[model samples]
Target chain A: MRLARLPWWAIIIVAGLAIVFYSFFTSPLYRRALIFVTDDPRLTTTRFANVIYDVRTDEGGIRRVEGVFVGQRGDILNVETSRQVTIRVPRADIAALSCEPPASEGDCPVDATITLLRAQISGFLIFEDMGRFRIVTDDGERQEVRKFDVIIDAVQRTPENCPPSPEARCRVVLPLNPEREANQLSGTVLEANADDFLIELAPEVIVPVRQSDIVAVVRYTPAECALNNLVGCDSGIFLTLFVAVIAFALAVVIGLVAGLMRISDNPILYNAATVYVEVLRGVPLLVTLLFVNFALYVWLRDEFPKIAPTLQLIIAALALIVALSQAWSKRALLKSEPSSFWQPIVAAAIMGTTLVAVTGLFAANSDLPPLSRGILGLAICYGAYLAELFRAGIQSIGRGQMEAARSLGMSYLQAMRYIILPQAFRVVLPPLGNEFIAMLKDTALLTVIALPEMTQRARIFAADTFRVFEPYITIGALYLCMTLLLSVLVRAAERRLALPR
Target chain B: MAETPIILVQNVSKHFRTPRGVVHALRNVSLEVYPREVITIIGPSGSGKSTLLRCINRLETFDSGAIIVDGIALDTAANINRVRAEVGMVFQSFNLFPNYTALENICLAQRVVRKRSRKEAIEIARALLAKVGIPEKADAYPGQLSGGQQQRVAIARALAMQPKIMLFDEPTSALDPEMIKEVLDVMLQLAAEGMTMLVVSHEMGFARAAASRAIFMDQGEIVEQGDPQTLFTAPQSERMKIFLSKIIKH
Candidate 1:
């Protein structure tokens, strides 16, 4: 009993907050920022100069000097050190020279933190006149370093306010070659030439990249999404629920109306409902969805415009028929009673106006959005099944119940509302819960229309990551958990509402 | 004899179309009951006694003739609800609403058709439940109550509409032997109060004890009708004799 008294709402609130917090911190923007700050030093590190010169001392031993290579003046080589001093070295004493910045060590000093990329030759300054730089690496492989090879330069941040003179040391990022990070650039190649390929980096921005550089080429099919927000966070679940809940709501309305019509005493109403049920039920749900999305929507967009005016004319003709019927039916009374002459005409005019409005509303919106089409397809398809279910539930009650209510002098509609529907609702509850679960799962089929529901998101994840089994298995587990939870809730509701027989 | 008849059925006939064939359930059945008169109808199986009672309230529409209750014709669509409200019916199986309690079952029609407020309906229902001798069982559902209690509740439900005439169609036939006396006791009290009643029953003891007139019916037609004592003692027709002989032995 004490455990039962525990505040379950508090626990749910805390759990919900935890999920939202986790979703927020791990969002793509924050993840990308974290990567920029923590990636390999070649991408973020900065230095004043990245030059190293190895020369022989007067004692016949070799010593190395690191600085920015200023220039060569005839017999002396000029270099600027981190201490802001220019030093001259006789060209004759020079043994080996390398432009690659040395790693942090006791002998090699750097003004700021910096890291260098590995190449046969590395140098701080490349001679643009020659269009190349020469440096000796630790491996001693003499390779040419071209100016065009360095794609991105150092990135700098704004200088923060410092004391005294207001000058501040700004943090700078190091330049890196584009080839090393080509694996991260996953997109389609827009245009390619011998020297470079024009690649679409994002939807709106395209950049020219060297042909020799490694690039991740990703080919996209028409069905696949290039960018979709519903796949992010836990929005896929929300999207699925949105479709299922809306479709279920619409289906309930349709099912109630059709179910009542199916059981009607009138042949016209019954036949209309029967035809609707037979046609919708005979077609598979997937085919219905495809027909709604592709065939119906396409026709509505392209062909419905031409037919809408004809539909209006047909509706007007039908309204005229209804008016004529009304007038003809009351002709004898009208002829006998002159004061009631305008009654049938007024009634017909009102009914005809209402009919036109109802039919004209549909003709007004020739094209429906994709999401609406998907929801409509699900609703109408399941509505037929639910209509049968509702009919069965209503029929399950004995005839005596109706008679008893009727004998009480209650109108037929009142008796149905007060007696029959309440009992029928009880009888159909468990089946209704089952339909909801089935419909929830059926929402996955809408991925054919490129809806970013849970299953669709999983498909996209599998295609992007090339790990086919993991994403699908995860989605299956999620669906299992959701359905199991829904089942428990429904059983609880049933228990709560149960009455002794 | 001076009072106007509260219910008049004139040449009323009903035919049911079954998959087997069309069968005449009621053939030119006619009856009249004055205000405060208690009439009990006795019949063999398929005698059309129940059909005649149902037609009086238009629960089952007749193929010909007319039924007028409390001077209101049953043929008029607008008058049907009014006539039904004036005439109450109790079924053989005590078709009490299982979804409602005994009190609510009585209150439903009063609140809906009579447009009584909830409090007023509840007050009237409580008074009627007490009158039926099941005041303590008012909160119990029909399913939970015994057949006698359910029948009493059905009587209270019918009386809650303040109807002018009451129609009983084998009201005690579904009850146990012990339970039948309790239901019959309520009907006897109603008879003593001089309520206009039409009862279809096989209980000759009740007919002999309370009915102002006893009728014998067979083959969808009334065979005999007379004072209860005279009709029970000296039957006029062979059909009546055979029916009485067969029923009286039980």
Candidate 2:
């Protein structure tokens, strides 16, 4: 009786959650750890944390030491070694600190504040805080993000061996298949726009490729792309799978209900379903996500920042509550020894985690998490398509079923429930399963909104490691595994429910 | 037979708009069936036999004409369902709800339309199953049943509705030769029990034994109609002779 009453998988899930929380919240780096760097993290020292230093000793050889950063005493910088021993460094002897160029006196204050803030958060990289670049001149640093054109124009480097002014010597790459080599033009870039691109391959020879034709603007060197690369946090496949499953679940419910409405006799219901299907179908998913994630999200934040995130949090919290409680319910959770006592705390923790995630979403100036935007976008889009599939499935049932039901006095809705949909579902299951696999792949599109799903997350790792092939190969295998697994599941379901011969 | 007709048809014509052209399936057909009349309709393919049967229950609406079943006029979509409920139909392909057990097939409409409780519906289903001589197969799905058994289940499903009239559109035509007997036996029992029925079948034996009247149709029109014995023995239209000679040889 006790065994039967015990909730299945509840203990395992709870234990898993506990381990995850421990690994994440404690000092141990959970899979992917985010680290952010300021423009020049040089001479300025504020909040002391671990730092690697290249120090020139009196013997004239450089020595590397890991130590805590201490504030500068005049021209001599103070430092504490890992051995608890204090050390002093004159400005001339201090060769390098944290791989950053020496910051001017004016830059030190901002750098100090950033370093202090970073230390306070235990070195976690909030997406918004990451990759923030600002131009700092001797006069006074402008308090704004550097635009692309400005950076391209101003930062011509002597070491890069490029022309001192204006045109950038770059390698322009065009999209190419594996069968062909990548089309690259090593030339001086003259001008580029949405429509046209002009590159001077040689002084006399100018090659023009359409912007639409270009695959990528290859950087001078394969270096760290902070926007696309990260060392650790999550392989982030779960984010993709989670959003896909949730969106698909939502889509199924919406599809079936709305699909029935389309064929229903009532004009209001029929017209409403028809309009929903037509409008949603017409609007491209990419456009919808972009609008919802950026424009819509920004407007909401600007107009009602407090209310927007609050309302979002409430919705997220309630959803989490429902989901977690349902999952935990198998344990007879509230009725169990720890439950009634531990329930509120667990509930709070769930809410807190979700809230943190939501906050992080906006922290990147993305307004909402890319996953949230992806889910809504995919669900609505797929729901429209599925509605059509469902309509066709329902129609495929023999007219005699309806006739049989109607002749026996069953109303249209009743006939559908009892006789029609069950048959339609049987016919539709295979296609619906195919749609699910398709949806799993489509989750990759959510990366446009910058969700750190597999493709987006792997690209981030690839940019960081400068190993494009390995990350891309891993991504391909992951997607293949997911789709294959989904196919197998669908087949198994079909087999289990196969009609007797 | 009752003085008042239980099923009435007057100048019913139906045309289907196909991609090729509009095909007139039923042309100015007129027929009346009194209470407890077992009328058998036999015709070549595309002769409007099944189309006419469908028209009675308003499953296939006539382009023009009037069909009154159980005194209710099948004139408007609003009243069509009510009229349909009084007329039960069995199809050539059985058209049994594939996902449901034979028992559930019988009970579904009874519970939904008649507001019968689960227990009452089950009881009615079981009784109809027994009447159809397949009570043991009540729990079996249509897919699991033989063609003959499926047709019987379809009959039982219709019977459970307690409809005033039953229409069968070539019920045994899709069945194997050996399976035809089981379905015909159930129809014979229904005819003996005096259920008003309209059947379209090629089986002249069943027509002669059970039908009060036999109708011969060709080119979307009734070629001839009479008592089955007279219709079969006496010479009438050329179409009737050709149809009967073709069917009766078997």
Candidate 3:
């Protein structure tokens, strides 16, 4: 039995779907596996005896604790302090827990702090004295009690040094008795209010104090999260569309100049136009774009301060105009009267100047609302190519037609306008349509300067989700669909304008 | 007798630039054509016949001479187009605008050079086409018509301008042997109506039947000049004798 062959795009789609399905299924599995393996008791028990881990406190100004677990139950543990004090807890007495990897794994050992403020430890704790406490664990039939020595790691001399208000993960150092010694106690504030602060004393112990006793206060600010979001969401689209519009506008101007110059009888104008076209056409579009944005923009910024961002637009317009005008002017100049050389150039100049001035004014005034740059850029770029097409179409008419017109007392201009241009324009329609289609595709270049076009929006979406592939794929599809639609429109126009055989 | 002639030539000479230095196409030649007189010029190839005819309309300027056509001198640029409009020309190739129909081709000169209204030009073109006996073919493009028909259209196009004098440059040369008769007949009819025409042709029968005056040219100079009947029967120059005998024998 033979299987049906899938189209390439279908294959790509299937592969993409498979990848998505696999990733979707595997994501949760990976997360669960990560949690379970890291929390495994086999590693924690072995590493917990020799290594003392500290969960820094907020009140003692991020003090480090050193302890070892000696006794264990479902929710209870006996932890021996660095001075050999063992603390025990009942099954339901533990409030919080965390795990860390062993030191030998090239990473610091995990330190976990458990706060017992919410737990009902009063039922299970044995108070030996004012400064000592113990915990009892019930192991079903037997009660295992562990007793160990107790000593103050460091006695705080002045309790007034603690911070008044504590934020998340903030620490405060307190001097319990400054008259007696210079000893200090470090504690992380577990909770805080305007008048009172709660801090973790040990793994499960928490102490509270009034804010009036404290002498210091500190605040930690969270990292600004909106900047990255803004850059990704807003700036990306804005810059791209901006650049594309500028480039397109420049292209139109270049087309007009080169088109008119090509037809000019003056060697200076014609040669300059030819050179411009040659240079632009020879260079890669990416190179030209970069050169305009980086080099030309920098050079012209001082001289033309009013048109800074629009410098790229100017350069793009100039480059495209040069390329397009050269081709058009050459074709037009060869076939048309010398006076006609000004038509495309004048039209393009007007369009370019108007577009540039408007865009510059808007850009200066902070009114680049949306997609205006992209539209302008596309118009400019395509206009140049169109002018050339017009020239070529005009030239395609036979010389006999011109001579006939002249013989009838029609001046050269009259003959070209009435007899030659009409026929030539019919011939040029197909190629002109092609140029328009190209222009539509080239609009994607707008992303460089942060215009909020479709592609830029997609990028922002991707960055937010940290899933880079999907958004780009979707964007690519959107662009392709748009370009295809434009191509279809151009083809329809070409057909409508096509001359009958 | 002292009054200026309708057309006057004073020692008119023409030289052409060529790769082999200046060619003396016409040399100190002079002639006058009165109003409404049919003048036929007969010459062998390279005898300055067509050049002389073109000079009369100022289409070909002479190097050193004065040609006064209908009262205005040909030397001035100011009167060139005006002169051309008055002295309409029919080319050997029938240089009609191929893109236009016969009627449009005829009407264009009338409307453009003469500044006539389109309606008036069209009416004049139609009448002229009828005069040439090809009114039915007025709507046909030049390319669609035969050589004889196109030549007749060319004649009609020139006449539409309402020129006083018509210069024919070997009008029948490019036509077929049978088609030549049609164009010659039109010329003969024009001549009988006392139209001032300068025609360069080798058609002996046309000269004899329609030409009031026949001038024979050899070596860029007039070899003999007289009435067509007298010129054909007895020539003054040996060159004319040889040329006429050769033509008649053929």
Question: Which candidate number has the best lDDT?
Answer: 1
Superposed on the true chain A, the predicted chain A of model 3 yields a TM-score of 0.41
Candidate 3 per-residue C-alpha lDDT over A323-391 given as tens digits, one digit per residue, 9 for 90 to 100: 466457555343323334555455456655765675566545443333443454345445545556655
Residue-level lDDT tens digits of model 2 in A1-501: 265564778456445545544544452223232121111122333324334556555565655544444345545544445322111112221222231233543122211211100000011111112233232212222222222212223333333533211111221111112221111223333443332223343443112222333233332121122223221123266566777899999899779867876876445457778999999889987787777777876675566555556767775666466445544543433332233335444544664576567555554454555556678778888999899999889889988787777777776667778788877878899889999998898888877877767778776765654445445555665576568678879998888767665
lDDT of candidate model 3 versus the reference: 0.59
Give residue B52's error in model 2 in angstroms. Answer: 1.9
Best by TM-score: 1
All candidates: TM-score: 0.67, 0.57, 0.46
True contacts kept of each: 0.47, 0.62, 0.09
Model 3, C-alpha of A315: deviation from truth (Å):
20
Residue pair clashes in candidate 1: A99-A122, A99-A123, A100-A122
- Residue B79 alpha-carbon offset, candidate 1, angstroms: 2.9
**2 or 3, greater by DockQ:** 2
Deviation in Å, model 2, residue A165 alpha carbon? 38
Model 2 chain A scores worst on lDDT over the 10 consecutive residues at A114-123
Clash tally, candidates in order: 3, 7, 66
* lDDT (Cα atoms) of all candidates against the true structure: 0.70, 0.66, 0.59
